[model samples]
Target: RGLKFVIRKVTGRCELQRICHNNKPGARRTLKIGRPTYCLRIILCQSALSAHPDRVEKTIDDIMTLKKVNPDTNPQLGISLQASLFQIVGYRSLVAEVEKLRREPYDCENPDHEEMLMKLWKTLRPDSPLTGRISKQWCEIGFQGNDPKTDFRGMGLLGLHNLLYFAEHDKATALQVLHDSLQPKHSKMSKAEWEQKNFDKAIGYSFAIVGINITDLAYSLLVSGALKTHLYNVAPEMPSLSHFQQTFCYLMQEFHRFWIEEDPCDIMEFNRVRSKFHRRVLRQLKNPDMALCPHFAASDLHLVNL
Candidate 1:
C-alpha cells in the first residue's frame, strides 16, 4: 500500500511532467519515417485533433490523464505544452489534412475552388486569357475535354491544387515544360503531314493532365513508404505543404526530362515511359543520399505550418 501510494504521487516523464519541466521538443530530426513505432501508435490511439486549434490543446489534456501529473503544479505547462506539441506532431496533422484534401472532390460551385482552377490557367497561359470556362483552351494546357473538372476524378481537388502549386511555385520551369510538351515529335514534317497527324495527337504530351497524373504518383510516394529517403533527408525538421509541392515540382521537371530522353514515338508511350521513370526513381531512392529536389531549398516551413 505504501509503495503504490508513492508511485501515484511521483509522475514519470510522460506528457504532464515533461511539459512542466519545459522539455525541449526542439527539432525532431531523428524521427524515422514510414516504420511504425510503439510511441506513435500510442499517440494515434490515445488522442486525435477534432478540427480546431482547441482540439490540439484537448489532445494534450487527453495525454495528461495517462501521466497523472497535476497541471496546477506549473500553471504554464498546459499552454506551453500545447504550443510545443503542436509544432512537434503538427506534421502528422499536415499529412492527414493533405490526405483529406485528396479525398475532397473539386467543387465547381465553390468560388474559392474555381478561383484556384482559374489561377492554374492564368499562370500557365498568361498571354491567352480563357474566353469561357468551357472553352477548348483548357486543352492547350492538356485537359482531354473542354471541361477540366472531369479530369480530376480519382485525385479530386488535390489534382487541381497540385497542378496549380506547380504552376505557381515553379512558374518558369512549369511554363518551359508546358512549352516543351506542346512541341511536335517530327518538327521537320511538312504542313500536310502535320495536318493529317492532328495537332493534339501529335504533341509530346499534355501538361495539365500529366500534372494531375503525377499528383497521383506523388500521392503514392507520400502514402507508401518509398518517399522517406528523399523526404527524411530534405525536410530534416518536418514535412510541410511546400515540401510535398516541391516534390511535385521535382517530379514534373524530372518527368519532362525523362520523357524527352526516352524519345517516345507519341503521347501513347506515356504509361510505358512513366513506369520506367518510376522504376528509375525507386532505384535512385534506394541510395540514402538521393534527393529529389536537386538543391536542398524546400526546407522553408513558412508557407504553412507542418
Candidate 2:
C-alpha cells in the first residue's frame, strides 16, 4: 500500500525508480529523464551556488518548466536548462538596464549628458562645427527643427545612448547611413534631382529621427523576448548591451536601404514600411538557428544595386 522512490544522478541524465512491495522479483520500475548535468552540480556544490539563492532556485524551477514544455525538443543540441536560464536572466537584466535609461528623461541641465550629445554630433560630422545649442546644422543631420532635444522626448536618454554608440563605434558607417537617409537615390532621377526631391518627399523622416525610431523598435523586440531566439543561438552565455547596439546599427542601415527600395510616395507610408520590416525581422527571429550581428555584408544591406 506504500511506494518508495529513489533518484540517481549521472553525467548527462537522471534516473528515478519507484519501488513497490511485490512478491515477484525486479518489482522496481525506473524512469530515465534527460536532466542537464549542471542541475546536479548545483545540487551538490552548495558552496559554489550564486549569492542570490532565491534566484538560483527560481532558475532551477524555470529549468523544470522548460523541460516540461519541450520534453523531446533539444533546440541547442545538448543545451542545458541551466545554461538557457542564465542567458534568459542576463537578457532580462539588460532589459532592466536599458529600461532605466528609457525611463530617465534627458535633463538639459545635466552637463555630462549635454557634453555627450555635442560629442556625438562632433563625431558624426567631424568637419562641421557645433555652432550653438540650436541651429540649422541640427536639421542637416535630420532633426525636425533647429533643436535635437525635442526629438528625444519619446526615447529619452536611451535614444541618445543608442545614437551615440552607433556613431562612436562606427563613425563612417553611421555618417553614410545618415546621408543615405537624407538623400536616397532613385532609379530614374539623377543625383542632383534626387537630392532636390528628397527634401520635398521625405518630410518627417530623417537620419537622426529614424535612428531613434529604430532604437524604440529594437527595444520593443528585446522587451517582447523575440530577440532571445537570436541571442540564444549566437551568444551561448549572457548577451550585453553591445549586442543590442549592434542590432540597432544593422536595423538603422537596413531600414535606410529598405525605405529607398520601397520608394514610398511620402512619409505617410512610413508606418506601412515599418510594419512590413517589423514582420520581416520577426520572421527571421522565428528561425531556430538565425544568427545576426552588427557587421553585415554589402549584399545584406541591399547595396548591390547602388
Candidate 3:
C-alpha cells in the first residue's frame, strides 16, 4: 500500500509536514510510497522557494534521491541539508567572482588602464593637464609617493577601478571628499592658524591612498564572507562586481567622515581608527537582512534592527 501525504500552510506557504501510510491490502493510495517510508518535517521558506521555483524543485529532487538511497536517514535533516546546499553554492559563486577581481593585477602597460587613470585624475582636477608618467601632482591626489603605481601593489586593479568608478560616476561627491581629506577641521583656531598648523603637522594623509586601503578592506569583507548576509539580501538575483563597487563607495564616504570626526592627532593613529571602523562595519553585516543602499546616511550606516 502507498502512503497519503498531507500538505498544510505553516507561516506563509504550503509545507509537507506529515505522511500517513496505509498497510492494508488492496487499499487505494493517494501517493506512491517506496519501501521503508519516512515522514518529512522540512520547513522551507515558502516565499523564497516560490521566487526560485526551478532551483527549489531541483533541490527537492536531490533531497528525494537521498531519501530513496538512505531509507534509514533522519527526515529531520532534510530542511537543513537543502538550505546548506544552497548556501554552499552561493558562497562558492560569490568567492569565485570576488577572486577574479582580486587576482586582476593592474597593468601599467595597458593603454586602457592608463587612459582610465588619466581620466580619473582629470575628473578630480579639471584644471590639471594629463602627464605621460607619474608626477608630483600624484601626491596632490593622495598617492604615498611620486609614483602612484607603487600604491596599487597591494590592491591591484580593484583599487584603481574603485577610484575611477567614484570619480567618473559621482564627480562632485568624489571631489568634495578629496578636498575635505586635505583639510582637517581645527577647534578654536583661526583659518590662517589652522593652515599653518596643518603645514606643521604634515601628517601625510593622502585621499587617493586611503581610498585604495578602503578598497582592500571592502575586498576582505567579501572574501571573508562577512558581506554575504547583506549581499544575499540586496542582490538576491545575482551579485556582481557593481554591488562590490557600491560597497566600496559606502566605505570610502563613511571612512572619510569618520576620520574627520575622530580627528586623530597624527597619521600614526590611522591604524587604530581604521580598526574601529572595520569592527563597526562587521557588526552591521552580522544582521541577516542588512542591505547597503547607495543613499545611506553617514550617521545611520548601521543596519536597521529587524
Candidate 4:
C-alpha cells in the first residue's frame, strides 16, 4: 500500500511538470497580442506584394519561386510556385525570358528563371522574336554546364535543334547548331557510355523540341493568313509553283476541319474551289509508313498547346 501511494504521487508530479512544459497555448496568445503579430503582418504584405506587383498583370511570382531553391529556402515550394506560374501564365513566357537572356548576359550568381521567363514571354507575345532567342539561350546555358532543370536557357544543342522546326525559313543559326549537334562524335568512350552520359537526353529533347517548334511555326503561318494568300494567289502563268500551291492546299484541308472557327483554317477554306489544292498536299506529305513530314513533327505541338 505504501509503495503504490508513493508511485501515484510521483506519477502525478510528472504529469503536472509535463503540463507546465506545454505552455504553448499561453505563448501563442502572447504572440497574438504583440510584436509577433506585426512581424507576421509584414511577412504577409511581402508575400502578397511578391504575388501581385505593379499592375503588369504579369507577375513574376511563378519564377520567383525558383529563387526558393536557394539552400535557405525550399525546392518543393519553389516547384509548386512554378507550377502555379506555368498554369496561369503558360510556358511560352518562360521561353521568352530565356531568349532575351541569350541576347544579354544573366549573372551566374542570380541565374534567373530565364526558362520560365522565356516561356511566359512567348505566351503573351506569340510572334515575338524572343522565341528563336530562347533556342540560342539554351546553347549558351549548356556550354556553361548548368543543371538541366535549373539553367536550361534554350540555346543548347537541343535548343538549337528545337528552334529549327519553326525557324526553317528564318533562323540560319538554329539550323547550323542542329547540324553540329547530330554529327557523330568519335570518342574513346563506348556508345553505351556516351548515351548514358550525354546522347540519350540530348537526342530525346532534340526530337521533342524539333516537333514542338515546327508545330508552332506552322500554326503561325497558317493562322496568320499571309501564307495562305501567297499560296492561293500564285500567278497562273507560273506552272512551276502549282506544286507548292497543291502542298499548301492539302495541309489546309487536313487541318481546316479541325479548326473550323480559327483564322488559319477558315480563311483557306473560304472558297471551296480554292480548296482543290488542299487534296494535293495530303498526297505529297502523307505516306503509309506514317512517317511525319519534318514540318508535321514540329508544328503539331501548337495544335495541342494552343
Candidate 5:
C-alpha cells in the first residue's frame, strides 16, 4: 500500500528506496543500502543520465509505472524520487568526467599541461622563483624529485587539477598549509636522535604527494558511491568538478590536522593513518544527511568555517 512496500514488492529495494528514505514526518524508514542503487545504474546505459528534460521525465514516468506509485497520492514521494534520481545521474556523470582526466597522462610536451604546472608553482610559492621546470626547487613545495612530472604517474592530470584549484582559490589557506607541511615534524629531535631513530631531516609529508593521494582517495569514494550522501544533500542540482575539487580542498586541510593529531612516528605510518581517516569518513557518509565539505550551503569553500 505504501510507496516503500510497493516498490520493494516490484523490485527488492529499488534505487529510489535506497536513496530516498530519511527520518522525516510520514517518510519511510531509511534504508542504508548502496548495492541496489548502483545495480539500477548497471541496468541503464551511461547515457541514461541524460541532461535533457524530456528524457529525465520519461525515466521518472517509467519508475512510477514500474513501482506502481501514483504521483497524485504520493506527490511528496515523487518529488523525493526525482531528487534522488538526480543525485544518481549527477554522481555517475561526474565519475565519467573525472575518470577521463585521471586516464590522461601528464604531458610535459603539451603547453597547457606545462603552464598549469607552472601556475601551481607560482601560486604556492609567490616569492620563491622556479629555477627551472626540472629544478630541485620543486621540492620546496613537496615535489618528490627534480622532475615533478613523474609524481603525477597514477593521478595524472586530475592530481594537478586538484592541487592547482587549492592553490588558486584558497590561496591563503593553501599557502599556510604548504608552509606548515615544510616545517620539520619533530621539533625536539636533536641530530644524534635523528640518526638514532631514522627520522625525516625536514618536511613531514610532501604536500604535493599528499594532495595527489587525497585526490585518489576522493576519486575512490566517488566511484564507490560513498560520496552520494554528501553530494545528494549538499547539491540539489548536478554534482560537478567544482564539487569534487572543493571536497579535495576539505580533505587536504582535514588530513593535515588529522596527521598532527595522530602524532605519527614516521612517514611510513601514512597508510595506517590514511586508512583510519577513510574509514571514519565512510562511517560519516553512512548518515544520509552527511555533507563532507559544507554542511550548510554549496559555495567555493570560503574555507574559514572549515
Candidate 6:
C-alpha cells in the first residue's frame, strides 16, 4: 500500500512533527519500503506561483500525458500526482501556537498574555483579503476575554467578526457576556428586533473605532453567532456598507434596551457619544397625544400635561 504522511508543527515550538497513524482516513503513516509521495499540513503554504484554476487541471493533464509517453521512466510520477491530490496546507503553524497557549499555565491576567496576544496579532498581518492565520489562531485558542478585541482593534470590523466567530465557536458564554456588556437597558421591543438594533449600534460605534475598512467578515461572524445561536435572530448577510450602517444602528437600539434594564450608567451620557461621522443623534419617544400608552415608550410622555 502507498504510504501517506501528515506533518504538523508541535504546539508553540515552531518545529514540525508527525502525528501518529491510527488507520484514520488520511492519517500519517511511516513506510518501511519506498518513500510515499503524499504529505499534508494543517495549513497550506502560500504558493508563489499563481496557478489559474483551469491551468491546474490542464497541468495535471500534461503530467499524465508525459507519464503515458514514457511509463518505464515514470514510476514515481503517479505517486507525485497522488500526493498532490491528497495534500493540504496553510496556517497550521498558528494553530500549533494557539494550542500551546491553551496548555500553558500562564495566567491570563498576567501581563504576558497581552504580550502574547499582540505578538499573535502581528503574526496575522495578511496582505490578502481572507486572513487564514487569524482564523486558525482563534479556532485553536478560543477567546481570551476582551484582550483579543483590544489587541486586534486596528484589524477593523472583519477582524472583529472573525475573532467573534472563533470566540463563539469556542467560548459562546464569553461572546454572550460581551454582547450583554454592550447591550442597552430595558426594552418593550421584540428580542429579534432588539438584537438587530444592538448589532446596528455596535457596528456604528465600531466604525468610529475602526473607520473605513473591511467589515463584512466581522459582521457576518457576529450575526451568525448572535442570531443563529438564538442570542437574537436577525439578517445574516450584511452585504454592503449601507447595510452595515443600518445594522449598526439596529444594534445600538438593542444595546440601549440592555443599558436601560442594566442601568450601568447615566443614559444621557451614553447618547453624548461622538457619532460616526458626527451625525446628530435622533431620539425616539412616544407621544401621549397619540394612541400609544405612556409606559409603552421609555422616554417621557409630555402628554401628561396635554
Per-residue lDDT of candidate 1, residues 1-306 (tens digit): 465456545754443343335433332222221123355446634444443566666765755554464677755656655654444455565568679888999888999989999999999989988999998888888898988888988788888888888787767778888877876667676777655635564457888888988998888877775665566555544466777878888888889899888988877888999999888988877665556763224334222212
- The TM-score, computed over Cα atoms with residue i paired to residue i, of candidate 4 is 0.18
Candidate 5 lDDT over 1-306, as tens digits, reads 387567777765444544555433111222232234454344334324585555656676766676567778766656665555555666778999999999999999999999999999989988888877789788778888899899999899999999998888777888888877766666776767554532244546888999999999999998997877676656665678898998888888888889888988778889999999999889887776567773223354333211
Best by lDDT: 5
- TM-scores, all candidates, are 0.70, 0.70, 0.67, 0.18, 0.79, 0.21
Candidate 2: lDDT of 162?
87
- In Å, residue 130's CA in model 2 sits off its true spot by 1.7
Give lDDT tens digits, candidate 3, residues 1-306. Answer: 212322222321122223212211111111111112333223223323332546655655654564453324545334433443344344446567667766777788989878878887888989978565767767768877667878888887778888988777667778888877666444554677655534323433677888889998998898887877665555433455776777788788888878878878878888998999999899987655566655433322343332
Candidate 2, residues 238-297, lDDT tens digits: the string is 567777777788888778778878878778788899998999889877654565556543
Error of 4 at 7 (Å): 99
- The stretch of ten residues in a row with the least summed lDDT in candidate 1 is 26-35
Q: Rate the local accuracy (lDDT) of all candidates.
A: 0.68, 0.64, 0.62, 0.31, 0.73, 0.30
- Model 5, CA-based lDDT: 0.73
RMSD values, in order shown: 6.8, 10.6, 11.0, 24.9, 5.6, 22.1
- Candidate that would win on TM-score: 5
State how far residue 190 of model 2 sits from its true place (Å): 10
| Candidate 3 displacement at residue 1 in angstroms | 25
Q: lDDT of candidate 4 vs native?
A: 0.31
Q: How high is the lDDT of residue 89 in model 4? A: 26
Q: Give per-residue lDDT, candidate 2, residue 252.
A: 84
**Clash count of each predicted structure:** 0, 0, 0, 41, 0, 32
The worst-scoring run of ten residues by lDDT in candidate 4 lies at 297-306
Please give the lDDT score at residue 303 for candidate 3: 39
Report the lDDT tens digits of candidate 4 across residue range 71-120.
23433333333323222222123233334433443332443444544543
